[model samples]
Target: MINVNEVVETNEMIEKENLDVRTITLGISLLDCISSDLEQLNKNIYNKIYEAAKDLVATGEQISREFGIPIVNKRISVTPIALIGGAACRTKEDFASIAQTLDKVAKAVGVNFIGGYSALVSKGMTPADKLLIESIPLALSTTDVVCSSINVGSTKTGINMDAVRLMGTIVKETAEATKENDSLGCAKLVVFCNAPDDNPFMAGAFHGVTEADKIINVGVSGPGVVKTALEKVRGESFEILCETIKKTAFKVTRVGQLVAREASERLGVPFGIIDLSLAPTPAIGDSVADILHEIGVEHAGAPGTTAALALLNDQVKKGGVMASSYVGGLSGAFIPVSEDQGMINAVEAGALTLEKLEAMTCVCSVGLDMIAIPGDTRDTTIAGIIADEMAIGMINQKTTAVRLIPVIGKGVGETVEFGGLLGYAPIMPVNQFSCDAFVDRGGRIPAPVHSFKN
Candidate 1:
């Protein structure tokens, strides 16, 4: 056990570096479970996931208790359902049923969420893709832990307008179906460009084609630890601050690597990537917004937030890469609007706006996650937000996503409760400009020019 002096040192390092363990995800590939018979396929999937992750939650809890640090989330990601059910299901019902089975396995194992009820429709939709999209609302509404995503854009294939349009309707439907929770179900759906296959994060985590049959990925988070550490080191020079942050990130990511190794070894699964995204929680100490405030922003989403995030991202990636050779996913800061209490407070106080958040995404890991908008938000406006994020990812050749909630009957400044994990968000307003012209030019935007350097 670490002594009080060591604990003080750890806290100092955490505050100075803005470092914490974000999440630890177990990836279970379901391709082998695919069968012509729908029931057989579902059964195979359930057995595979259940067998692979039965001890995941228990293992995580044990590690957290032993380490004396919090492991924020324990999650599972599986092979994209579109491909897994391609040979079995001919209709949307099959997709819904498959998602239901996945959700059941997740709950049974005590995991917070199960991702990969999703599709990669960047170029075009397969028969299975269409069905998967259609069944997403039903799947998410009925299941407590199921999350979905659609990859409609990539640097190689550009953005698929048709698929994007379909997702707009899907998001609206998902929100309306879960209207009692202020469109919380839609908060669990993300649209991504350059989505990672081995991501251990929620709403957008799915095992890609390149992934092995089964693997363990860890995302470590400790915003509270980071915040506490930052408070200790007052009036440091910028270079000193950067060095401090890098060292702190190194320690946090090392802890993540340790947990990942133990979990993978015990589970008899191949070790996957460690995503170093600084995911926030709703607690007071566990906040990315508080980190910003500690960094002299005084308020999150303020003028200095973007520059601060840029520095934070660079320092985190440098430290995480040094800590683990297997680092992947969006390995930087996450500024999800609803999940962090500071962010919700800022939105409610009108200190954070959509435009400022967009700028922050340029420097953060993902874009516009869990943002709540007025109930009357136009579909075109939602599409515009997604388009902006995809464009950023395509041009920069990085992964970015948007998961915005259009709360029913809630306008700007109103609050919506999404219960545990999803949290609550204050409704934000969007620009009222007509994006119909841009959205109507609905052909596939070709891959970026710089994508062919190889």
Candidate 2:
């Protein structure tokens, strides 16, 4: 089982191809931390997260050093605060106080970000869910490391148009609240359809109520490695090309499997899924768009882009599932505009647009991710966009998320710098056409006929 060539190949991927374990996320459930007393609830939440993740960063670093694999981030995802704070959080501020506690524990444990300042309202919002949803703007604005997400739709439950409409206004408020930082608060917030519980990624990661009390999940990324493999079979037949990608993905995911097992064993936590997403960075060569280009697209949003992405996504799953028994989360290619330089280049070259990106999300892992839009764009328009994406997930029964930054004081044709992993984005124009009447219909979009399978 131990092959010298495979070891050398993995080293090459790491050293030359930007292959790395994207994140080692500790999922800690906050259900037990719930209390009727607000102060006690906050304190209990803080201590639970702190104890669960205190060794996370150090453990990740140790594994990286020992194995010579780069582990990019150590993070945590907790149960939705709405559920945990239901009894104590009477107002939006009360929920925001919970976010502050999350931020404090994240800093104390030394993780990059902590997710699940979230409310799951795929069908309807409860009193607690509504409070947490309303608190997102304040919670994200005040906290440094805490991230928030709202699940507004799911296949089984249908889309909550009310939540979608409110999120549109909430997104705008978040942008205004953090305008000084180029709407960085919005960068940490996401809206999802069919959001996964054990997603080792942010700003969508949350410990689903179904997960164990504590577990370790790892996300691995290697777009450059995939591209490099495809290059070797350039101009080859479709069969050959697909074979190349599958083999390459298998190798890359094996690295994640190793890391996940080691991290779990060391941390004394059960190992969760390995999210083998082709999560690109701002770094050149590490882009899913580049992989698409290697697969025969001139640019990411080109005519055959969606088909190309579907192929890649399918093969990635086919190969990755073989590498580990537990393969979950959004396990495919991520097409975040700001995070991938190739996508950024595509946008600037006018080869990619919001419309094209939305079409692409039908095949990719996530939806309309890390996109910056004009501040003046109406919240109704944003609601309409979210509804459209959610409809895609509902019909297709796949996970799709939106992490849009409506950069305040910015408009189309301008660029906003988010720095680090968020990278920068050229503000893209949105349809000026009004969708107020459509969004004003404040009711749920019933689940599709396929959802009644049982």
Angstrom error of the Cα, residue 73, model 1: value is: 2.7
lDDT of 2 by residue, 110-198 (tens): 99999999999998989999989888889988999999999999999999999999999999999999999999999999999999999
- Model 2 pairs in collision: none
lDDT of 1 at 269: 84
The prediction achieving the highest TM-score against the true structure is 2
Question: Which stretches of candidate 2 lie above 4 Å from their native place?
Answer: none
Give the whole-model CA lDDT for all candidates, comma-separated: 0.84, 0.94
Q: Which stretches of candidate 1 lie over 4 Å from their true place?
A: 1-22
Error of 1 at 6 (Å): 4.0
lDDT per residue for candidate 1 within 65-88, as digits (tens), equals 776556767899998999999898
